[model samples]
Target: MENEISSKSTYRLLYRVKPFLAITFLQFGFAGMDVFSKVALNQGVSNYVLVVYRHAIATAVIAPFAVILDKKVRPKMTFSIFTKLMLLSLLEPVIDQNLYYFGLKYTTATFAAAMYNILPAITFLMACVFGLEKVTLKSIHSQAKVVGTVATVAGAMLMTLVKGPVIELIWTKGRNNQGVKGGGTNIHDSIKGSLMITVGCFSWACFIILQAITLKTYPAELSLTAWICLLGTAQGTIVALVMERGKTSVWSIHWDTKFLAALYSGIVCSGLAYYIQGVVMKDRGPVFVTAFNPLSMIIVAVMSSFILAEQMYLGRVIGAIVIVAGLYFVVWGKSKEYKSGSPSTDGQMVQDKQMTDTSSDSNENSTPEVITLNVSSRGGATRDEQINRQSDQLLV
Candidate 1:
């Protein structure tokens, strides 16, 4: 009995922390992708071609599971959903990814990862613009989010504009600078890379927002991920061909870091990450899904210093610290907002149940109905509406 009780306790604990573990593992995978992708790019792998190959591999790996597991749950694909999928592919797989690779080429992996820390801020801003987020000035949580967004942007600028003295680590100390200039040494390259990454973040934010919107009509995470990868592969191939033109050699693959990088990034970052994030977003919402980006930045900073002999600066460190602080503010505010709203949500659910019961009693022949609670008073639907829609669909 004691053993069984202990096993149940363990299971409950794992269930409670599952999302945390999943997102943390995702950060490790993303950090590895940054490091390996940097190495592969250094070894003459074309960023355009890399994007194509990555999506191709992702499609191949993810399609089968999507076909089998999501067969029943997958919604009928409409032209609207198809169009959204195309745009989704374009945003992340083609535009955002290409720009990110170009930025990574100009900047160190650590810098690029640090720059990505602003993703939640970008996502929050976009959500607000789209009416998916409510910004009430009187709310303390809203105030925290606004201040956090500003702090995040300021930190990004500091990281981009200021390159202080190098803070050498034991791994990077006394090492030959490996023919690679520190990201901050060249002002022009830093500006160029920073611009590309910042723009890429916007594209990424758009992708995430659209993804949440798309999931309303198409709720199958696996199938949706497969479609995105397959469509992205097609779109990315066209972009690669145009960019590489006559440079067929850029497509060549060998048993080296280049091929390994493509394989790892495809399966881990593109395929698994998309599916996992989609699942998490259904429950926690988009902002929650992006809140953990700083974890990957921290991982990349340490891994790059040890593995790539990348030099870190005091300014970058300070910026990273500030970014992390801003990220937590956003997360804490979101959490508090959710907690404060839970009682209302519960009350709404009970009211919905009472209405359903009343309708059933009034008409004996009436079929059970699914109630979609539009919790947001704003003009646009929030993630709560999406969740309610998904639940309604499941009931049907």
Candidate 2:
């Protein structure tokens, strides 16, 4: 009886902090990747080769797990879903990641991360245009989201355009003065790099919109992620071969920092990060997932300062604070909206029981679907079971 009580308390604690923990893990992992990738890029590793190796490793690791974990209830693959996955591969690892890494090669990691703060606004606009989001200006929730988006945009621009006084950090300055040299972030290169990251953000927004739609058809998160990695590996390999054609030296990987970059990024940033995101999106919503992106900016900024001895300007600090404020506003609005609009516990319990019945009766000749996915819902139905039931309904 005592043991059972302990276990229940642990479960309750974990459930309460899951969202915070997930986003925190993601930001730290991503920040580490940024630092490692920068070091590899500085060591003259080709961006295309980095992409190929990263995705290849991600595919290998994720595929077996996906197959094993999702085998029982995994939906059969269709040509249509495969086509959409292919497009997703092209959008993310191909266009978005390629541009992002290349831009990272030229700019400071802090700046590169700050540029990504614009993604929420870009995604919000795309969602509105695609009819996925319904915006009522009269609603405080909607207004908060809109204003937060605008603030995020303003913060990004401020960081990009305005370079102010450097905030003195004694540790970074003293350490750097002792013969350590930071990477160059020249004005001209910074401009070019910023533009690339901006475009990458646009591609990422498109990817999110498409991924949401695709999840309606292909509800198997792990399976979908594995497919994306596999296809992305192929696409990245083709790009790498084309770019490094006749240059055998570019393909060489020593058991050094470059190799570590590929391995760590493949396992953590690509495979695990994407999987965590899929789970988070299914539990919460996309806005909630993206709302934590600004946290990454903060993480990267602090990490870059300590690791690279990178200078922090007043503008960057001020802008990052603004971005974080905006992020909280957006999250607050989303939370309020979810609470106000979401169904009560009794209704959710009824739906959960209905879904359980539908899933038990489901068979192969079914289309998968998911509906009303909310983080705050206190239903007994698990996310996967919910998706399974939705898939069963699709068949009808």
Q: Which residue pairs clash within candidate 2? A: 368-391, 369-391
lDDT: worst 10-residue window of model 2: 342-351
For every model in order, what is the number of clashing pairs? 0, 2
* Best prediction by lDDT: 1
Q: In model 2, what is the error at residue 85, expressed in angstroms?
A: 0.7
lDDT of 1 by residue, 1-396 (tens): 576555655644554366667888899999999999998887779999899889899999999999999987788988999999999999999999999999998888988987887898888877777666677888888888788777776676677567699887777878744486434457688779889988998899999889877876787889999999999999999988987999988889999999999999999999999998887665456776787887788789888888888878888788878877877787677667754443222123233444655687568865544333324354265434544454444445
TM-score of each: 0.83, 0.84
Model 2 regions more than 4 Å off: 1-16, 174-184, 342-396
Error of 1 at 396 (Å): 26
